[model samples]
Target: MPWPVAAHRSRLLLRGRILLDLRHPGAAIEELREACGILDVEEAADAVRGPALLDLARALRESGAEDGETRRALLRAQRAAGDDPELLLPCLAALAAFHDAAGEAGEADETYERAVLLAPADGALRCQLLTAWGESLLRRASTRDGAGIVDRAEYVLREALKSLPARSAQRGRLQGLVGSALAQRFRHLGFLPDLFESRHLLGQAVRAAADAAVRAEVWLQLGRVRLEGWHHAGAPVLMDALQAYESAEREAQAAHGSDPGSVTAARARHGSGAVLALMGRPGAARSAYTAAREQWQRLVGALREVDWADVELTRRVESEPATGEGRTRAERELRDREEGDWERVAPPWWPWTGEWSNWSEFDRS
Candidate 1:
């Protein structure tokens, strides 16, 4: 209501923060802007300006506004926070997520790497960054990519897990993400070890997850990995994979029987069809596949928008041959997305212009 000045700075700041948390970024921006306006940075403590500016940047970013003003606000927040790890950690994470949500994977990875380095002992944050980085790498994968990315992603996820305390919530999440990544890697390179490891990790994730939906998804992933393994190797593996898919189907049914057209639900149904087909049950598999196809059509019919950003019209996937990476393929892809056209949006630090992309150059004291 009343303008925020010295006496009411803290209260205004708190209100802005609450609004941001409640996803009312537009309202938060108003309070934050006026509050910050009332106090001069040179006169205000770093604690005050740093956090307030960071929140303002967050407000800006969350409101679907990733303009230069928002970028400058984050940079100012960083400068105000200086070398305070407490302030810097969150600022970096916000910046990284901003990049990630904007589809700027390279920038997100770079920012996350800096955050990881900034807090070497903070396993939780390190695990978070590593997990995000690994995910980005996998998403950047193409048919032209090599197995090294899968290898690197698996390694990174393993390392990410080590950062969390045993059996912690964060640890469980990383385990699930790692499992998903491993499954992807196995699919790419046809590596037995990757499939086995993926199965193990997904098992842990399934056990740890209390939510039926989450566990269902993990079961589906594990089932797919096992099914692929069965395709390449036979006998006991085939049976194991069939069981996994069946388990996934059961979980999916339990989780979302009311929502037959949901992504996970359709995936489960499709996966079950794959299992049926693999087992040479043509009649049953045909029925299952038909059902799955109907579910997919339902999904397409349900799209609220003519062009939903969430749906990819065409998915471009380039994968290496079983033999190895090809010269032309290697040139086009990153060893799991380490390299690409992303350079256009990633030429330099958008915030600092030219003052080093990372926080290493900052003075601690």
Candidate 2:
């Protein structure tokens, strides 16, 4: 950790961080590799090496590099961190996130547990780790064994929220995660209380959200909560749900570029279609579903030219094309509509019911 060498490595790391923030992962990866290379042969550069290696791993992952390299770099960072909690905790968090994204639930849980245990109880790092851990659990909350996981996720995110200030930058995001977890719990347990609480929290998240993308997602979740509440509680929440979906659509359109914006917009349209179907508006529902389908097709067409970095999107496009059986079904539905067969467009076998699962891919925060 010589002063001159440390300063140089610090400059490189800072530049790499800025590049990564700007979405220039390729350039970030190069700068971070150079930073990590600075202390490669130095026996006492462990302090510098840990953070540099972690940044390198992040940049590599963002650049779509091979998973092996990313994992190796993370492991090296942990080793270099030695007994330093400041460095080790971040390494653990990143490693946990990597495991979570790879669907290794067991390993992710273990790593997150270790990080939580090591992080100071009231520290910002603890909140950050819990947020990531909760989000990971939330992502898996739709699986068969989702009941317990979603409940745990709710508790974790709530605890994280307790450590955050009311108007903190991360508060809205934490609230949204908690709301999502509760919403998933309601979906699993059929509890009206959970749905109500989820709607409340998501509303707060929407109001507090600083980023348009975050607001869009919160609004979308709120719409789902409202729709479910309307169905079960028999309240006048249908219009409310439609409003939320429309809000989400606008926010997503304004917040993102072509690729991700199209995906979010499609989800919002599908959500609107669901609400319209529930409102007994068959024609409107059909139109909304058609718009959603078209948007998804457009997204697939755009991504077909490039390698899809999102595995879920790739899976959907490959397995659930709008052509073939899907197109045939659409044509039959259209003919039914043309023949004034509104009854056939009702629930249980409608387009939204049949294809909602495929169209419901959500973005991670």
Candidate 3:
């Protein structure tokens, strides 16, 4: 490839990343696909082929492409990466995240381990990989037989924090992850010591967070710990949890420039509602729940309006239409998924039916 041609492809890759960040995944997919196609045609383009495929995979994921397509892209990138740790580590991390999302815990764990072992002694990249692995563990810890997972998550996150200086930018976020993992353990065992330590670490995280969005999440986690404390202690802890939730709501709103439909804001509002109900304030709880419902409704409505079909995937499927019945079934499934995305996205705490009976037990308590 000539220098100018290589530069042009680089520019396309950069533009695709920018579009992805700006939430234009469909456009990003087009730009990245062309860049990947350019590299594919070159006889000796292995140097850039891996990165181009990786970018294309990211764009496809953001565009809601099928898991199989995304997996194939990642696998291709991995093969092209061949022995280059710089390229291979990222491919591994993305594959780990994909496997984690699909609930393939063994694959996710193995991939994360490989990436971690291949990483250099210490740096931002190593820290990031550790953090991603820890978070994945924390998520899995929410399921059955999770006590061991919590311990592993805590160990992994703490190891990442050990190399960081006090004022390092990642300190607050790592602290938050460690705290959350400990909180999960506390829930599992009703261990007051874990609860106390989690509260303390999360408080530090909130104070040290460089980003408002991160601070908001820390605040929310702090509220959860305090609420758990209340279950064991008393009313004072309940009030403290309520204050944490209020701070979370404010910080979440500030982080997104007061976007009323922010997912974090909705979560904060839902937390507030739960705290209010626990505090025997039915009217206030109802008001908070109503606000959360409205915010979630806006988000759901926006998602429903998106055109989820990937143009390339659609064309390929269309080209091989063996029977009309097959196309009709595929169409029906896509429509069903779009219609039910809200149910999949919404948290279990969300009031799906808007019935006061859903909270009657709490009210009576």
Best by TM-score: 2
**Residue 9 of candidate 2: its Cα lDDT?**
74
lDDT of 1 at 117: 85
Screening candidate 1 with a backbone cut-off below 3 angstroms (N, C-alpha, C), the clashing residue pairs are 142-318, 143-318, 143-319, 144-318, 144-319
Report the Cα RMSD per candidate: 11.4, 8.2, 16.0
Model 1, span 1-365: residue lDDT tens: 34444558777777988887687999889888877876564367877787777778777876767578788887787787788988887678667766765678778878877887886676555666676666555555422353556676667767777777776755555677678777766656766887778778888888887666666667766776666554445423545755665676676677667343355555555556545444445355456556655665666786622222212211110011121124343332222124323221111110100011122112122
- Residues 184-270 of candidate 2 have per-residue lDDT tens digits of 888789888898898889888998889888887788778877766755675535789889888988888888654534566677777
Ranking by TM-score: 2, 3, 1
Superposed Cα deviation of residue 273, candidate 2 (Å):
1.6
List ranges where model 3 is wrong by over 4 Å: 1-25, 28-31, 257-259, 301-365
Give the TM-score comparing model 2 with the true structure, all chains together.
0.76
The better candidate by lDDT, 2 or 3, is 2
Task: Give the better candidate number (1 or 3) by lDDT.
Answer: 3
User: Clashes in each model (backbone N, CA, C under 3 Å)?
Assistant: 5, 0, 0
Backbone steric clashes in candidate 3, count = 0
| TM-scores for every candidate against the unseen true structure | 0.72, 0.76, 0.73
